[model samples]
Target: MKKIRKSKTEQLNFGNYSFEVIKKKIKNIYFRVYPSKGKIIVSAPFSIDSETLNKAILSKSDWLNKQVKKAAIAKPEPVKTYITGEKLLFKGEIYSLYVDYRHTGPRVAKTFDKVIHLKVKPGTDFPQREKIIISWYRKELKRSIGMYIDKWQPRIGVTVNEFNVRKMKTRWGSCNVNAKRIWLNLALIKCAEKFLEYVIVHEMIHLLERKHNARFKSLMDRFIPDWKRLKKELNRFSL
Candidate 1:
């Protein structure tokens, strides 16, 4: 039987580029670049020495430089103020918002021509209004997540114990394989429904394979043939 090496992480600096290197029991080295901040991460096998790793990184300097340049000039999304006539993203579609101050509980509804109607009590402040919209997003996302779980659990042949939604800064979703629980990012509600489903399926797959290895990629291909594309598209959105 083959033994797996325990993974360890360390920081490496090469001139202007710094990388977070994780030495794991893996066959090949992998590089990931975060376009938003030009962060680079390298996953290398435990057997690789620092000299070899440095050489490998140097070979990819051109590609890394291009990615960092793009990040330097990247434009960030505008901050939302949750006001009337402001465009909001939901299910990958943008909708113009209409705020209605009524003597009623906070409610949100969608009407014709891609418009979202948000009804709140009179004298509601900005934070209050934002809270109301967030509450509505959570409710709708939960409802849809329940339906997707029901639909995919049978096909995937995995029984999830439970799932939760919350605001996550880094990850779209995560699965606790032993507990059979999944956590989805609350921000997913703003993207397309397909993106949400992709995240769900990705987390569920972790129940079967804990690591993102060849076996995991094979399983993803079997389930979501275009998952590579979906993943690329989904990452284009900020957390």
Candidate 2:
């Protein structure tokens, strides 16, 4: 078995723009721009030298500008202060935030009335409060992901060594075939359960077929007949 190398990352600056360059065991270079945050990420093969990569990226300057301009058309939402009255997204529904002061450690819970109660010690700062909520999201997401993985493993005729949840701006999920691990985005917690299931199944199918070719589509079609509609709806949300 070929051991996967830890991808090397560096910052690349060209003119007025900066890119997060990541070199991985990939065949081709891929550029992804997150318009909501104006973040640019470049993934290239390790065999390619920086000079060639720079030239390739520089050549796409025009395309990058167009994407940036298109993104500018939509106004970005204001930054969240993680205070009361702010909306919290959970399971594809918006909930009003309710902060509860307590002598106990920080925690998060949702009420029957669509309110997310964030319980924290008195005088907990914004960063700490945000961290608490994120921690809660991670735990909840992991539990849900486990349920899906267990439910699909036998059906798909594959087993996963492990799965992880993280904040990803570009992709919802990724599969490390060699590691038998799948990474689910923390953002998926905000989407509907069906959308989350769609992503999970999509990544699981990668174990059978690494590339997204006809065989992959056939597997997806057999497993999720309406995945195309789910994918369309899921993309409407910002990562």
Candidate 3:
């Protein structure tokens, strides 16, 4: 019942990169740039000719090369100081930080107009403030992931035995295919909700396919055709 499906694939050498062009029953041509492997995949309509695809790739060659180079030397995110004027990102939106120390307790809230309100006792050091902010991040990310799990578990025909949120340096999420447990990067709290959902579905899909092979990509295409785009958005954040 999937509306969009891949029909075939063609490989070609274009510009400085060798990539695959996936012919699909889709409306628009799409490109996916991967950060970990510095790979690229292009999906285009079945009717599109090779010359057109070549031109498209050539046009974006420079940007593509930069992305690959960036991926090759990707850096880890530095520890945050959580000071005033620093920005926080949530659900794809930016929130400016405002720290208030007048109150006796530490608090965190997102205002209706797009600002993150942080309140802590005076003289609170970095460690204490970090704990407070991370606690809030975990709580919020958990709530969001729970909803996604509820929505996707049944659809994907999988159950997660355990869900964990932790600080991760290399990956956004991981699935213990044997244990039915999924661990999400704590940093995801700063990403948009769509990417969060994509990661959840990506991990859950592992329950059905253990490898990122053709079958896995096919499943992802069926479940979330826009997953490639979501992955790019998710990795836009460092670390």
Q: List the candidate 3 regions with Cα displacement exceeding 4 Å.
A: 1-79
Model 2 pairs whose backbones collide? none
- Please provide, for model 2 over 1-239, each residue's C-alpha lDDT reduced to its tens digit, 9 standing for 90 to 100: 99878799988898778898899989999988877667789999989987899899889999998655434433233577789999777876678898999998677889999999998899999999989898998999999999999999999999999999999988999999999999999988877799999999999999999998999999999999999998876776677
Query: 1-239, model 1: which lDDT tens digit per residue?
Result: 99656998999999798999999989988988876555798999989998999999999999888666434323244677788988777776678899999999788998768999999888899999889898989998999899999998988899999998999998899999999999999988888899899899999999889999999999899989999999987776767
Give per-model TM-scores: 0.68, 0.68, 0.66
Q: What is the lDDT of candidate 3?
A: 0.83
Q: Number of clashing residue pairs in every model?
A: 0, 0, 1
Model 2: lDDT equals 0.87
Residue-pair clash count for candidate 1: 0
Q: Report each candidate's C-alpha RMSD, comma-separated, in the order given.
A: 13.3, 14.6, 13.0
**lDDT by residue (tens digit), candidate 3, 81-150:** 8888876666656677788896577889889998888899899888887788889989999999999999
Q: After superposing candidate 2, which stretches have Cα over 4 Å from the reference?
A: 1-77
Candidate 1 regions off by >4 Å?
1-75
lDDT of each: 0.86, 0.87, 0.83
Name the weakest run of 10 consecutive residues (lDDT summed) in model 1. 68-77
